[model samples]
Target: MGNIVKERKSRPVNLDIKTIRFPITAIASIMHRVAGVITFVSIAILLWLLSLSLSSPSGFETASAIVDSFFVKFVLWGILTALAYHIVGGIRHLMQDIGYFEELETGAKSAQVAFALTGVLSVLAGILVW
Candidate 1:
């Protein structure tokens, strides 16, 4: 006699990423990725600013005017904030790779500390920019 095999039914798919609760480490990792992308894009803006400032006297004046704008200052502040976060996150990653904060509890705590440091430095960056 041949035995029958049973097939299990698949569950419905949930496509919303927002419905999931991510851990602090996961959030920090995602933020680190986003900050890296922001920093990469900011490089083009920086280069343009540099070129405008260094090309000629008129160019320098134009660059100065652009830099003096409130919107430009805000954008620069955001870029700097992203840079600060990316740097802090990178340091934490490096330490982890070197065997520090390897445990789950310690890793989570480090993530929290990195975020706090980022917040403080972001405020400082905003202050300096304004």
Candidate 2:
């Protein structure tokens, strides 16, 4: 009985992979989800601006002034960055749909390339828009 219980209590063995290596498509998929969230938040900002502009002439002026401020410009930069990344990443996905990056090694390299491109482009968009 003691031996039987000890054997039963032993945990199942699991593969130990300290570093999880995910493919390019997987990372792109995750980034798409995150960018979607950012876009959704941007929609909220648009609504707030619309409301401010709709209240009255002074309201519109106030909204205009607000938009011209450093804080508003920074927020706009974030929105642009999100949009840029989402657009580039989406194009990469489209490429994959067309039979590109089908190989495991090529897919991983392409994903790294896509990530780098998104970063560079998003930064450029931010600088220009801000």
Candidate 3:
């Protein structure tokens, strides 16, 4: 009995990623990652569309019809929005790496600027898409 080590029972750790309060900079970083994945997946769809359009006249018509569909247009708009935000976020990250927005205040300001720019551009893209 003495040789048997008793395991201590402790309260379970309350670490929940979703329950954590994230700062604007952290949120921006997370959005950047999400946008990157969206853009990457969109590339495959775009390539498939390109191939279809280039295959033959019937293929081109089908591709055109697909593009004209409301669902496809919405998806395309979302992809473009993701691209715009990703580009803005990437530029902010690059600036941070160059020591421009390393400070907390400047970093927050840069993130806000990126978000504002992306929002404006995304609106423009939506207008064009519609």
Cα RMSD (Å) per model?
2.9, 4.8, 3.8
- Candidates ranked by lDDT, best first? 1, 3, 2
The alpha-carbon deviation from the true structure for residue 89 of candidate 2, after best TM-score superposition, in angstroms, is 1.1
lDDT of 3 at 111: 91
Instruction: Give the TM-scores of the predictions, in the order they appear.
Output: 0.88, 0.69, 0.84
Candidate 1 backbone collisions, by pair: none
- Residue-level lDDT of model 2, residues 73-103, one tens digit each, is 8888878777777887778778889999778
Better of 1 and 3 by lDDT: 1
Across 1-130, the per-residue lDDT of candidate 3 in tens digits comes to: 4798889999887689888787899999999999999999999999999999999999999999999999999999999999999999999999889879998888888999999999999999999999
Query: Candidate 1 has what TM-score?
Result: 0.88
lDDT of each: 0.96, 0.82, 0.94
Q: How does candidate 1 score on lDDT?
A: 0.96
Clash total of candidate 3: 0
lDDT value, candidate 2, whole model: 0.82
Residue 89, model 2: lDDT of 75
